[model samples]
Target: MEGCKRLEQLPKSIGSLSCLTNLNLSHCDRLANLQIHILEQPSPLESGLQRRKIIVHLPGEINKLSSLVNLSIDGRIHIQLLNLIGDAEHISCIPKQQTPDELLLSRCYVLKSLNIKRTRYNKDGSSFSCISFSDFHSLTELKLINLNILTIPDDIGQLQSLEKLDLSGNDFKSLPTSMTNLSRLKYARLSNCIKLVALPELTQLQTLKLSGCSNLRSLLNLSHAFHERVRYGLLELGLDNCRNFKSLSYQVRQLTSLIHLDLSRHDFEEIPESIRELSSLGTLCLNNCKKIKSVKDLPESLKHLYAHGCDSLENVSLSSNHSIEKLDLSHCFGMKQDEHLITQILNDGFSQVVCFLNNYSLVN
Candidate 1:
């Protein structure tokens, strides 16, 4: 019954399906009521102790369906709220004749990856209080986008196996401090969260992307051992378009382990001299930083520098030890007037560097 857009209800007699193993009612925009009974008789398809399983991409209440252990929502579903109610212990083994997709969902005792993006909610008020994290112990990846959720439950920290979490395009002002307890978390993306004012300390994360979070004013507390110079696990950090941050120097001084750093679309007049302290840094992106007038004193370990669209940029200063192999300065018209600056950048010491200038690219 999936994609049955006009399906408003089901017949009560449909409960007689003693061998019904799969029921997918996804994209049923008008489904308002569910009237189905559990099929107690085991099919000859399985032996004595075996039971059949059901996969429901449903829209209504399904607490009575004990065989349903997993629910997946996609772009096809038009439901307002996804109500989840069931036990996890009675998970059934998937039928061998099932499609590969169904087999993947049934293999796990509970949902492993739950993604809900751009979902509309009721006007009265909305809540995800019914969902519990403890039930999904094996869950590894979770993404909740543009849900307009104000707060995530503190129990979110209980997802100890969670590795990647993307909560972009939401309305939360702050995350629960308990989120820091996700010990295995590696990648975290919270982009375009316009109203988000602060974030919890996620020192264990490897990749943290927070682009377009305009209201986020600070991340100084991201490292509890900032003064002690403890190396954080963060390797790639993106803060592009975060215009309201008070300081860029101190903001990243503690992130010395960073390898890729993106500071694009900012209004700063200069690349922070403190960036030189990131000895392990290799790729630095300063694209579209129109207000920056010069590029100087970069890290020696840097291998790629992308500073294109910086029209006010007039100077290029590279130390003899700079190992930059790819340099992009396209659209830095200010430096075009001074041939010496280009010559200095293309000096014999950096013959291996491939430079991209305004209107044309060159390999030296």
Candidate 2:
């Protein structure tokens, strides 16, 4: 019930209460195991189809909830419940220690939402097949964090109802072409997937994040027709740390509805003139882009600009229509303390501009 910290196991007879629907066993830090089984076979006189349904909260015993509809587990413990019966509406598992095979989740047909974080395999350099979710046609949100997974299964396109998918902090080198068919997908995060070389075409995607994917060399061959379909719904795009990309301003200008753009830590030498076309751009972060020499042609819709650590930038030319509220230029070694630049920035009516000069003064 409450604060059962030392609880190590559940009583087998606990299943006798066939009508029990809610169970809260959270914060039982010392709990390590649990066993479950059906109790008291249903009699013919029972009114409804006699089935077990429950909600459980434990550290590493989720496998015991074979009839669970909602389950939450703690730490980074792997789970294996492929043949589970009930249709779980929500399931959260923070894997502690185990391989992908140990996570045997192949047959959860009615599962709707699955979240996993910090799941690592038992040994380094070990590979595993992607968990198939074709049976979970009702799934909506899926998250996988720090899994160290090398590849995503090609069959993932089958989940037509999936709305959000996050695959951050993995080792995937590429995605299957089937990803383009996810028409209902709205939000996607692929941050820190350093080895990811390319992306599958995302036609109906609204939010796309590729932050810290250093090896990502190019955007897939997305044409103008594809851009038009995503313009209104696409809101955020992150290409931070994609150093190999030669030019993105031309490609990015197509997303007229883009609100946030991050291109930090790259090899770009100049902000292209085409950047002024993003009339809806709100937030832009260009930190650590050392080759950039100046800031020019920024859109008036820009609200936040982060140019910190750009040691090669010599000047910043802000337009009179600038609406920037927050500007960060810390550690910009090449930018001299010019009174005109400060006066111009203030005259632009910005609320806050952090300029950490070498002289140790906050120029706002």
Candidate 3:
């Protein structure tokens, strides 16, 4: 029911809707207990709305509903509904998302997406050493953000249908090799996982973001993951501030399928000659790469080139046929160029590129 604000408790007869596919108990603030009748009787609850602030303690009986497919328990209040529902079928209430015994996941075989984000472990309690995942093979998107788990179960690889996986802000040092088994995975976000050092090869992955994985060196050597992307033809790659990256694979030249590459604040002193081989390269970011000395030999497909903080950059190569859309070189005080060249590009009827060269010295 949409406006069931005062619906304190669902009656046993309410579970009699056998064919009921979607259940909207979002505003049922007074609902406290999840009875078995809700799981076994009226009908299999298909679409569950969990916006209710007072509907806490979803019963362990939820496991009995084989037809239950989608469950959205967003906010801390709805999350409390889970805390009381431990793996134990006898639990009268749902436990916190980080239950001492979160063993019921295996029962949800048809669940398409399981997003259990943000957890608080009991300070004085040390319970389950592992969260079970052997049963979530059908999950298409699995997001376990900020769980603070030290390790992810290797069974995560079993999600053969998974398309997106976000494991940001965790303490894990490395990913299990089983993660490579996600054959259908397209997007993977591991940002701010400061302790993460190693990653598995994702062959079908299209977008791989590892923005703040600064400590990856302690877990694995650098850039082995990049080689995996090169082999698999990744399209969008973000390695911003990956502290340990000093060199790129020679095979990086082979990444002809790359579209967007973000290397801002990285340690590479010079642009790789192999980068010119990326015929599909669209955006190349080298912002704050202070040691870079030159900017030249870009691929024909480049649309945006950002090298703003390259203070040592003294030379740049540009031709009239270039297709650059935006070029940022504002801090390159060392570069000496003819004023006419910049003027021609800015005033040319055929030029659509926006250039920023604030500190450049104009020569005759």
lDDT of 1 by residue, 1-364 (tens): 8777777677765545666655676666565455454444555744455544444445342322234433432222223324333211111111113344654555223445656554432223232322545544566887766555566777789888889998886677898899889999999999888888888878889999999888888765634544565557899999888888866797688788999999999999899878999999999999999999988999999999999899888787888777888888988887664566557656755666767678667666
Candidate 2 lDDT (Cα, 0 to 1): 0.67
Residue-level lDDT tens digits of model 2 in 280-322: 8898888999999988889999888888899998888778878
For lDDT, candidate 2 versus 3, the one ahead is 2
Q: Each model's C-alpha lDDT? A: 0.69, 0.67, 0.61
In model 2, state the lDDT of residue 261: 82
TM-score of every candidate: 0.70, 0.70, 0.65
Over 1-364, each residue of candidate 3 has an lDDT whose tens digit, in order, gives 6445455455656434444434455444345443433333322236854322223343233443332333433333223332211211111212223222443544443445655554432323222223557655566887766655577878788878889888776677888888777888999988778778767656578888888788754222335644453366589888777767534645356456889998777666568788888988999988887777877788878888888877887777766666677777777766656465577556554345666675642222
Residue 199 displacement (Å), model 2? 1.4
Worst 10 residues of 2 by lDDT: 82-91
Instruction: In model 2, state the lDDT of residue 294.
Output: 89
Segments in model 2 whose C-alpha atoms lie over 4 Å from true places: 1-70, 83-108, 119-125, 222-232, 352-364
Query: Candidates 1 and 3: which is better by lDDT?
Result: 1
